[model samples]
Target: MTHPSTDTATSALPPLIKGPHERRLGVVALVATLGGLLFGYDTGVINGALLPMTQELGLTSITEGVVTSSLLFGAALGAVTIGRLSDAWGRRRTILLLAVLFFVGTINCVSAPSFEVLVIGRVLLGLAVGGASAVVPVFLAELAPYEIRGSLSGRNEVMIVSGQLAAFVVNAIIGNVLGHVDGVWRIMLAVAALPAIALFFGMLRMPESPRWLLSKGRNEDAVRVLSTIRSPERAEAEARDIRATVALEERTTTAGLGEVLRNKWLVRIVVIGIGVAVFQQLTGINSILYYGQVVLAESGFGAQAALIANIAPGIIGVVGAFVALWMMERVNRRTTFITGYALTAICHFLIGFASVSVPTDSAARPYILLILIVAFVGSMQTFLNVATWVLLSEIFPLRIRALGMGISVFCLWVTNALLSLYFPTIIGTFGITGSFFGFAAVNALALVAMIRFLPETRGRTLEAVEEGVTTGAIFTIRSRSRHR
Candidate 1:
């Protein structure tokens, strides 16, 4: 029942305690991540479901690519547009809207009697996924105390991987139990609606992001929300910081996207954000997520085995994310990015090398390739995926945070869409070896990009990061709140 007295509230706050406040924050993060769960299940379900879908719809390779890539293209658009909408409409409201979209999209997908309707449904779901990608991490970052922001924002990422794991398991069970059964894919697709429903109802009870409230000049509301997840002294101090940052930021008020582009520092950060997004996608992770079954079958596994084998990466991905949550609190952001790229690039090359070196009928290529792919996914979840989203959430100023994330993820999905669109063809022409070799080359370039362009945002408050980036002090590799 202790309250932060007026005197201490104006002074520095004490360190955080691990108790009710942390539990409440954890609850909020979990609820918000229901959106992320939908994101993963909707995206990853297609990997196992596509074959059955193709059988029923009589899809050609070209149409299969279209059906798969259409959602990614829609995600690109959704990332940009719905993200912008969140800035205007508020984070909670936008997420609620996305939830409804997820449910409707799932229903559309489940009931689609033809390929065209299914693609339309996939596009609709993509909007929800893309919007969540843009907004959920931001919401978590804003709600969390700066000291633990990395791990808290990272929860959404864990949920994303968990959802993918759920999808893989569900598909394995359904596809195996009802092998080639009519509309088996629809059962897999329909599982997504449950989380969408949870997200809609769960978000209803969550508070608006305090930072967003502060941006709207609702300081009292901001502090109230913060207090629920932080100590009163911490909440008040945090609210004060947010309010000052909001007041100081120009682009958020009078300036628009055009104005932000004109500012070189903002533009630099935005460009870097976009490049990071592209890098994460180009690691060829989604190639495995969306088309793993195809890759495995070609590598020599039977359809049933590939379906089961795909679950391995899903399991490792979730495990890696849990590891990442721990690392996010302890490691430097730039270090993880560099290490992730180096490790993933090496794994990519090994997969390519092993794919070609081993005989096609050796009966070992599938297992070898599977191990390498799982390692690549592990390296990614442990280093890149969580760090990528955390950096995007924290790198930009509050004024342009939404824009930076939206545009960056837009580019990410665009790259993903292109890769998805052409990957079947890539596999057709060049096979697994060539496609992965190409991924290796891309990761090499991405590693260089990370070393040079990525900055350390760990131990920095959002306001501190903004000041460092805008004032060009970021080059000094220091922050205003490093001690915190």
Candidate 2:
């Protein structure tokens, strides 16, 4: 059976009995996205906390690196492991498990008295962060209607950045006001627990992914869940389409690691997924997020000024994400990716030039570099970051969606882990000029790869995209002239 077009399905379905369903969906999306918020705060809090933490714990530079990267290491494992677990157990259950882990991990970080114990805590938090990153967007996508999936799934990224911004603001306040207090860093670490608690409580009322239920041969339950989020007519139509796609796949061998490797088209798409995941990090975005204060200080700002300056990028990041949400509905994903890279690569070049051309002692040098950095962050948020996560959530076939996403994001977290571990050394060895110049080169290559390989998924249903993937028609599908 052929998949029905979303428009035709919606048209044939009854007029949406709007009120309670939309509100419920909105609430579910909000509660589910709390995972994104915790993911942000836990990862970003360390930026400012690490300095005071070092003094309190008597940490060496090596130990500090270990503490910072340990979370990333844990996240890589979480992305893959939790992804597979979500596939087996279900998305809602996996996320609920992550919520409990977030609470426990935050408590560990807040109470730890030694560096070794703190690293252990960070590893736990990392696992939660990684799991959320891998699962939350897909959860939202699976629950959302095809027409609104981009915006709904993309909201998780906005929440992620918002969480990061909240961490920056909180760290700034605590760092400046409580700089003299004993263990001020503990306060920063402890604040994350609030969201963890919120996530756990919020998820209790949320629904499981309907697509997942359908996958498990529970069609009635899938329709029931879908009805809560969709109009009655739309719900039944979507259920029919999903069942058709699942039945088609069941006629063939199951998709797995072996199947992905043996099928040339599947391998091609998986490689594309990995490439986007890697290039997203290679843009040098996280290095800035994880170490913005350090980068600013190196640009010649005083310690206090550098801490305050870090908040600028965070502000612009949120603003840019709003722009991205607006654009995701109108623009093609491939176009957005290419535009983001071009803008960021140019910003990277200007940052390098400003660092070298302006004398270190000049009053304007740091401010100039700060503006360029903010521009880069804004460009990245507007195009690359949100679009990348949304595409990852939508691109894979239903059979291996979770596993494929886990593997792709696993590579992303690994790249992020390596950079978080060695970013300081890169700066120490090459200085700002060399480091940003390298980012420029990497982004240039990224732009080319996006143009050649990235398929546009702006207005298609997840099932429709899966059909294209299975038939190898995605690569040949031209960009839609007008977004629906």
Candidate 3:
């Protein structure tokens, strides 16, 4: 029989308690988020590392594209493949495996004597990065108390951007201090292994996902694990809710591939999740980061000055992510997403309108666009990026959470990779005006799609989320039930 008190159990979580229990959960999230740090570092390091690497490796344009893009394509592969692996093997074990991959990949890149070897090493690291991207937030979400789950899981996004900022700073300092050193890029590659080492050792002491355990019928183990993170009273209550939900899923949810196609809710939620993931990229944020220098140069800045100015967005990105984290605790996620997408769309339109309206020779044109680009970056990091990841982590039912996240993120990467490959050609053919106009259109459509399909996820337990999402009840405000 269900305990009457169990219904109010989730509400028992005190927001921002700052107690020992909160500290313990915070530590676990930090340890796991090292994967995110590695993700950011590995991706961003290439921005600076590529120049020196090409000088030493004798890379042609085609090969250079290959080297720069190998990780992205590899990340797409890793997100899908490792995502399934986590579902079966478990989130913690999969992350530990990712740690090993990160270490091996870093060493391989640092030691590679040829372009082929370096590309191979980059692909290996991409797998780890993609794996971490999929699993870390999910791991944190499962362990977090509902009251602070948004802030807690959001730490991964903060770490990712922070890691990117760290890479930019590290690359700048190392390249300057040892500007003449041979193979300095190798030293840059070597820095990632330290965090990988930390992630591996840190996760060793962490507990498995209690929700995963509950789904697997390890009831006592689930409650025991929860006890460490939650007060004993709340742990028992949350476990009961999870147990009941899992049992219901076992009985009613049988959507294999063919069945999934037949099942409207299954198909709808998966499709919605994929769209949500892809929409984040369609905002043209990654396209901007990838080609910020090109945009700056077109604005008439000198190469070195453009290079330095580009860091402004990266710095603002980090600041915005922290703001997003603090806001995550206070704001509803749907509100944040719609607000962000709307803001970015407006910024993109203004950029397009300005690019055409203002004379290219005008001195103020560059500064005007620069401010707009920074605002666009700020809006994205502050609202869309972190929320997208956090939403991806928690939106699916437990049965298909990793798989849903994997496929969605795979599409997200594929979209990002596509933009990266073709963005230069886009600007070449249509110039900045046409390209950003296209971006504005895409974001506008995305905003509508989201408002129509996106569900409110704030202040819900994983079990509550699973119930609402799978049944299609979450999309309708009044239809959604509050767990508390």
The candidate maximizing TM-score is 2
The parts of candidate 3 lying over 4 Å away from their true place are 1-18, 254-256, 478-484
Which one is best on lDDT? Answer: 2
lDDT tens string, model 3, 1-484? 2212223545654334345666787788899999999998898888778778989999986677678778878888999899888988989999999999999999999999999999999999989988988899899999987778898899999999988888877777787777699999999889998999999999999989998898778898888888788777677877877887777878777525565677787788889889989999899987766667778887767766676777888899999999999998788887898899999999999999999999999999888989989999999999999999999998888888888889888888887777776777788899989999999999999989877778788877787777666666776762242221
What TM-score goes with each of the models?
A: 0.95, 0.97, 0.93
Q: Which residue pairs clash within candidate 2?
A: none
lDDT tens digits by residue: candidate 1, 169-274: 9999998898757899999999999989998999899999999999888888888888888888778777776776777774344336886777788888899899
Question: Considering TM-score, which of the candidate structures 1 and 3 is the better prediction for this target?
Answer: 1
- For residue 89, give model 2's deviation from the true position in Å: 0.9
Off by over 4 Å in 2: 2-17, 479-484
lDDT of 1 at 447: 94
Deviation from native of the Cα of residue 347 in model 2, angstroms: 0.3
Candidate 3 residue 407 Cα shift, in angstroms, is: 0.8
lDDT of candidates 1 onward, in order: 0.87, 0.90, 0.84
Ranking by lDDT: 2, 1, 3
TM-score, model 1 to reference: 0.95
Candidate 1, pairs of clashing residues: none
How much does candidate 2 score in TM-score? 0.97
